[model samples]
Target: MTESKDVNAGSTASKERVAQFNQRFDFGSYAETRQFLDELAELSKRDDYYPDVSFGKTYANISIDGEGQAALREMNSTFIADMQALVTKTKN
Candidate 1:
Protein backbone atom coordinates (compact mmCIF):
# COMPACT_ATOMS: atom_id res chain seq x y z
CA MET A 1 0.00 0.00 0.00
CA THR A 2 1.14 3.58 -0.55
CA GLU A 3 2.64 5.30 2.47
CA SER A 4 0.11 8.01 1.65
CA LYS A 5 -2.77 5.76 2.45
CA ASP A 6 -4.77 5.23 5.71
CA VAL A 7 -2.77 7.85 7.59
CA ASN A 8 -5.97 9.40 8.87
CA ALA A 9 -6.56 6.31 10.95
CA GLY A 10 -3.87 7.77 13.18
CA SER A 11 -4.71 11.45 12.97
CA THR A 12 -7.02 13.97 14.56
CA ALA A 13 -10.80 13.54 14.54
CA SER A 14 -11.61 17.09 13.52
CA LYS A 15 -14.28 17.45 10.89
CA GLU A 16 -13.11 18.55 7.47
CA ARG A 17 -12.67 22.30 7.47
CA VAL A 18 -12.12 24.94 4.77
CA ALA A 19 -9.49 27.32 5.99
CA GLN A 20 -7.07 30.19 5.16
CA PHE A 21 -3.71 31.22 6.54
CA ASN A 22 -1.59 34.39 6.94
CA GLN A 23 1.66 34.91 8.76
CA ARG A 24 4.99 36.68 9.30
CA PHE A 25 8.20 35.22 7.84
CA ASP A 26 11.93 35.70 7.74
CA PHE A 27 11.77 38.41 5.03
CA GLY A 28 9.82 41.46 3.82
CA SER A 29 6.18 42.28 4.60
CA TYR A 30 4.62 39.16 3.16
CA ALA A 31 7.73 37.13 2.61
CA GLU A 32 6.76 34.52 5.15
CA THR A 33 3.48 33.97 3.36
CA ARG A 34 5.29 33.55 0.08
CA GLN A 35 7.79 31.24 1.65
CA PHE A 36 4.92 29.28 3.16
CA LEU A 37 3.34 28.88 -0.26
CA ASP A 38 6.62 28.04 -1.99
CA GLU A 39 7.48 25.42 0.55
CA LEU A 40 3.95 23.99 0.39
CA ALA A 41 4.19 23.77 -3.39
CA GLU A 42 7.56 22.10 -3.08
CA LEU A 43 6.17 19.57 -0.64
CA SER A 44 3.16 18.84 -2.83
CA LYS A 45 5.51 18.27 -5.75
CA ARG A 46 7.56 15.75 -3.82
CA ASP A 47 4.50 13.80 -2.69
CA ASP A 48 2.34 14.29 -5.75
CA TYR A 49 -0.26 16.02 -3.59
CA TYR A 50 -1.03 19.36 -5.18
CA PRO A 51 -3.94 21.54 -4.08
CA ASP A 52 -5.73 24.55 -5.54
CA VAL A 53 -4.14 27.99 -5.18
CA SER A 54 -5.96 31.32 -5.22
CA PHE A 55 -4.12 34.61 -4.76
CA GLY A 56 -5.68 37.74 -3.31
CA LYS A 57 -4.69 41.14 -2.01
CA THR A 58 -3.81 39.96 1.50
CA TYR A 59 -3.96 36.16 1.38
CA ALA A 60 -3.77 33.04 -0.73
CA ASN A 61 -5.97 29.97 -0.47
CA ILE A 62 -3.05 27.80 -1.34
CA SER A 63 -4.55 24.39 -0.96
CA ILE A 64 -2.44 22.05 1.05
CA ASP A 65 -4.25 19.00 -0.33
CA GLY A 66 -7.34 17.87 -2.13
CA GLU A 67 -9.94 15.04 -2.15
CA GLY A 68 -7.58 12.62 -0.44
CA GLN A 69 -7.99 14.54 2.80
CA ALA A 70 -9.10 11.68 5.02
CA ALA A 71 -5.48 11.00 5.66
CA LEU A 72 -4.06 14.50 5.46
CA ARG A 73 -3.69 14.91 9.18
CA GLU A 74 -1.84 11.64 9.36
CA MET A 75 0.44 12.39 6.42
CA ASN A 76 1.45 15.67 7.97
CA SER A 77 1.85 14.22 11.42
CA THR A 78 4.11 11.42 10.28
CA PHE A 79 5.38 10.94 6.73
CA ILE A 80 5.40 14.64 5.90
CA ALA A 81 6.43 16.28 9.11
CA ASP A 82 8.87 18.39 7.15
CA MET A 83 5.99 19.88 5.21
CA GLN A 84 3.94 20.34 8.36
CA ALA A 85 6.71 22.32 10.00
CA LEU A 86 6.79 24.84 7.16
CA VAL A 87 3.14 25.84 7.39
CA THR A 88 2.60 28.37 10.18
CA LYS A 89 -0.76 29.72 9.17
CA THR A 90 -4.21 28.23 8.66
CA LYS A 91 -7.82 29.49 8.42
CA ASN A 92 -11.04 27.79 9.27
Candidate 2:
Protein backbone atom coordinates (compact mmCIF):
# COMPACT_ATOMS: atom_id res chain seq x y z
CA MET A 1 0.00 0.00 0.00
CA THR A 2 1.07 3.53 -0.69
CA GLU A 3 1.46 6.29 1.90
CA SER A 4 -0.72 9.34 1.54
CA LYS A 5 0.42 12.83 2.53
CA ASP A 6 -3.08 14.10 2.00
CA VAL A 7 -4.60 14.20 5.47
CA ASN A 8 -7.93 15.44 4.20
CA ALA A 9 -9.94 12.32 3.66
CA GLY A 10 -12.07 12.25 0.57
CA SER A 11 -15.81 11.72 0.52
CA THR A 12 -17.62 8.38 0.56
CA ALA A 13 -17.64 8.55 -3.22
CA SER A 14 -13.85 8.61 -3.20
CA LYS A 15 -13.81 5.69 -0.82
CA GLU A 16 -16.09 3.76 -3.19
CA ARG A 17 -13.78 4.53 -6.07
CA VAL A 18 -10.69 3.30 -4.24
CA ALA A 19 -9.85 -0.21 -3.15
CA GLN A 20 -7.98 0.69 0.02
CA PHE A 21 -7.86 2.98 3.05
CA ASN A 22 -4.49 4.55 3.69
CA GLN A 23 -3.66 7.05 6.40
CA ARG A 24 -0.90 7.98 8.81
CA PHE A 25 -1.15 9.30 12.34
CA ASP A 26 1.11 10.47 15.10
CA PHE A 27 0.32 9.42 18.64
CA GLY A 28 3.04 11.49 20.40
CA SER A 29 4.80 8.66 22.23
CA TYR A 30 5.61 4.98 22.10
CA ALA A 31 3.13 4.20 24.84
CA GLU A 32 0.36 6.17 23.19
CA THR A 33 1.13 4.58 19.88
CA ARG A 34 1.00 1.14 21.42
CA GLN A 35 -2.32 1.94 23.02
CA PHE A 36 -3.66 3.07 19.68
CA LEU A 37 -2.45 -0.12 18.02
CA ASP A 38 -4.00 -2.23 20.71
CA GLU A 39 -7.31 -0.53 20.17
CA LEU A 40 -7.00 -1.08 16.45
CA ALA A 41 -6.23 -4.76 16.97
CA GLU A 42 -9.30 -5.21 19.09
CA LEU A 43 -11.41 -3.39 16.56
CA SER A 44 -10.09 -5.57 13.75
CA LYS A 45 -10.89 -8.71 15.65
CA ARG A 46 -14.35 -7.53 16.56
CA ASP A 47 -15.23 -6.28 13.09
CA ASP A 48 -13.24 -8.91 11.17
CA TYR A 49 -11.79 -6.11 9.09
CA TYR A 50 -8.05 -6.45 9.43
CA PRO A 51 -5.72 -3.72 8.24
CA ASP A 52 -2.05 -3.24 7.48
CA VAL A 53 -0.59 -1.26 10.38
CA SER A 54 2.98 -0.02 10.62
CA PHE A 55 4.43 2.09 13.35
CA GLY A 56 7.55 3.22 15.12
CA LYS A 57 8.33 5.69 17.90
CA THR A 58 5.27 7.94 17.65
CA TYR A 59 3.78 7.47 14.20
CA ALA A 60 1.47 4.85 12.77
CA ASN A 61 0.62 4.14 9.18
CA ILE A 62 -2.49 2.08 8.44
CA SER A 63 -3.84 0.53 5.30
CA ILE A 64 -6.69 -1.86 4.61
CA ASP A 65 -7.05 -3.48 1.24
CA GLY A 66 -9.03 -6.52 0.24
CA GLU A 67 -12.19 -7.79 -1.41
CA GLY A 68 -15.75 -6.55 -0.81
CA GLN A 69 -15.92 -2.95 -1.87
CA ALA A 70 -18.95 -2.08 0.22
CA ALA A 71 -17.55 -3.60 3.36
CA LEU A 72 -14.22 -1.94 2.74
CA ARG A 73 -15.80 1.48 2.40
CA GLU A 74 -17.74 1.07 5.60
CA MET A 75 -14.74 -0.24 7.44
CA ASN A 76 -12.66 2.65 6.20
CA SER A 77 -15.08 5.17 7.64
CA THR A 78 -15.48 3.31 10.89
CA PHE A 79 -11.77 2.82 11.37
CA ILE A 80 -10.90 6.42 10.58
CA ALA A 81 -13.54 7.78 12.91
CA ASP A 82 -12.54 5.48 15.71
CA MET A 83 -8.92 6.41 15.24
CA GLN A 84 -9.78 10.08 15.39
CA ALA A 85 -11.72 9.45 18.54
CA LEU A 86 -8.80 7.66 20.05
CA VAL A 87 -6.56 10.60 19.31
CA THR A 88 -9.01 12.98 20.91
CA LYS A 89 -9.38 10.74 23.93
CA THR A 90 -5.66 10.53 24.37
CA LYS A 91 -5.26 14.26 24.15
CA ASN A 92 -7.75 14.93 26.91
The residue-by-residue lDDT of candidate 1 on 1-92, one tens digit each, is: 11234678345234334332222223333666566677777777776665556554445554343234545564653324554466544221
Error of 2 at 28 (Å): 1.6
Tell me the tens digit of each residue's lDDT in model 2 across 66-90.
4443675765647557766877786
Q: Which stretches of candidate 1 lie over 4 Å from their true place?
A: 1-28, 63-66, 70-84, 89-92
Q: Which ten residues in a row have the lowest lDDT in candidate 2?
A: 4-13
Q: Candidates' lDDT values, in order? A: 0.49, 0.70
Top of the candidates by TM-score: 2
Which runs in model 2 stand beyond 4 Å of their true positions?
1-19, 66-69, 73-77
Summed backbone clashes in each candidate are 2, 0
